[model samples]
Target: MRITPRPPETVAPADIDLFDPERFRSGDQHGAWRTLRETAPVWWHERAGQSGFWCVTRYAECERVLKDYRNFSSEHGTILASVGAPDPAGGATISLMDPPRHTALRTQAMRSFSHTVVRNRTPRVTARVAALVDRLGEGEQDLAELARSLPMAVTGELMGIEEQYWDRLAHWSAVGLTPEDPAFAVGASTAATLSTSHHEIFACFMEIIAHKRANPGDDLISALIALAPGGRPMDDGTLLLNCYSFMAGANSTTPHVINHTVLALAERPDLWRSVAADETLVPALVEEGARWTSTPYHLVRRAVNDVVLAGVPIAAGDWVCAWLPSANRDESVFADPYEFSLRTLPSPHLGFGAGPHYCIGAPLSRMALGVFFRELVRRFDGVDITAPPQHLYSNWINGFSSVPVRARRRPAVASSMPAAREGACAHGTS
Candidate 1:
């Protein structure tokens, strides 16, 4: 599926079923996306059971769709499942709303994951991640599983859930987001499984909400409960949906970025050593990983009115998906788009998306990534992939299903450890 340098003016729509669940099962998706970007920046994708949708492949076109909510609206939904259909959440989720109303809900939720809040929570988050790293012990481990544990810990803390529930919460989050994924497949009926799993998760959230209502605390649930939109506390149903939103936001996506960052940096010892030596570069490394991984490849939007995007006619009521991963790798937007570098990146990536529907969990995500990588570089000199990583067969999430890797702890320097002094100096501390 690799796109040749010179592709045809457009792709054969039949060959590329953008809605196919297996489309992303191999390395082919990347090339397929590249071809779409070059040949049909605004490509049409025909779904088997439903009406066809347009895929906005280039950075400009994707950003245009994301930013211009007037023409391309998210009110229908922001994922492929909701295309040409009403959002199951009934647009109660902030990510599925348009301006004004979206702004209010997003603002309320952002308070819980604001910069100051995340900065304050960093120490606990870091300590939690460090403990997880230590628990990795001295053997080959599935880095993906280890990475998955992190958001559970952090999000668990934010939601005031017991640590024991983290694993189940993570599982539910995965099953909820990608029921079509083989790991969560219970039978031929994925939608039914997802529906049942979501209800269970919702019940858990209701319990948390009920608890928070009676005994409010300094947790995200409390903050959300305290949130009053249009002069009244947000409804219980909205609260439940948003709480689930926060969990899914943190649980499902961040791990992919973490796994990708670890695998990518681990493979490049030179880059790993540079970051290990200087902690300041960790942010850049994290940013690069988000851009490189593009966890949620594309977000769905529906046309509110007829529009011409990149010379293609998109009719009113048409479903469109803005390809974020493709946008991050757009040649015109990024120099040497394929090369992974920690240096200052080109135009900021749309990994967390854009406009009013931008990811509110970004601050928390950064905190998790920052702590995870910093701890990883500080503790392990090398992370070698002992076996090929098993990738998730998901069109939405681009990540490792299992990354088997051996961790090589940094050798302890004897008594007057110059390495310790060098590390301190590099980190600018005593």
Candidate 2:
């Protein structure tokens, strides 16, 4: 459906510069977002110099929105921050789309990202992750670089793409996810960038699909292509859109989670120290980081049917952003939500989202995090950092281009560990 921006007066107040990506990038946004959650849990945010959105801060209200698909639709493409960005896929990707169409295509695309697929691809993933850690010697260093490299490289390898394109993939993924910052807004250029990448990726997929069509292989593309809905093959557009959905928001979010998780550890030494001591706790650390980082902080939902949340009345056509970073730290739900805790239990964090739209790649993300962190932590006994991490300026991705992490020579936790103890990282730390 074509959507033209309504008149300025008709726009909601939540659309404003206050939600600008630059503002959040300049500083950690938790404090301000937290204040709003408490003071005006469900408030309108219309600021000068930004697209408008309604911010839902409290956990209960956010839950109400996520679980009740009828009340809030995920079809609007899931981002309230980058209101102006154009999707190169012609319309909504899976995450942005509502069900039936979204569900059918997602079932195929999700097959590639399934746990077995990610597990099958782990050896390669582990090698890249370990190489990154090996370069950083034991010392105080920038955590962001250490965090981002694993997922950035993983995204490429998993897609069967060459390593050369990791930088561009990371860039696009970051840009698409965060819109509250100074990162370039979506427009003609974004479409160009997206189109360029899509062209390459689609070409690659088309080749693979054709190969599978002619001579079948065990790779995911083949399996997806083999899928027959009522004895007919999946169409090109559905297949392409499904694959595109996998690469869209995930690639950026993965690295951002890694960067933020490590950063969180650095800040909360207690948490970091705990995870380092017991590698088993690393999974919890990963979850906490993903929850706290809130790199892809805003998730948009359209009112599927009129409903009320947090005592606020809603109507169909109205849009809402479940400010996840804020919701994850809801005072009512978490004890000292602002305080980072590796020991936190039964985490109800919305990092992977909730209900049907909950990220289909949850297992892949979890597996990646498990392999990346466990191997790194186990290998580097004295994997101390070199210095503080730098932050990226992009509004869509909370990450760093460079983090100078030169670590000391710690005993190898395993035989095949990637040492990024020292090297040139793609994105620098803030």
> Please, what is the whole-model Cα lDDT of each candidate in the order they appear?
0.77, 0.61
Distance from true location, Cα of 418 in model 1, Å: 15
- Candidate 1 at 237: error in angstroms? 2.5
Worst 10-residue lDDT window for candidate 2 reads 1-10
Off by over 4 Å in 1: 1-14, 345-347, 413-430
Candidate 1 local Cα displacement, residue 227, angstroms: 2.8
The most accurate candidate by lDDT is 1
Clashes of each: 0, 62
* Model 2: per-residue Cα lDDT at residue 25: 55
Q: What's each prediction's TM-score?
A: 0.90, 0.77
TM-score of 2: 0.77
Tens-digit lDDT track for model 2 on 221-275?
5666777654677788767665566666566677767665655554455655566
Looking at model 2, residue 119 earns an lDDT score of: 74
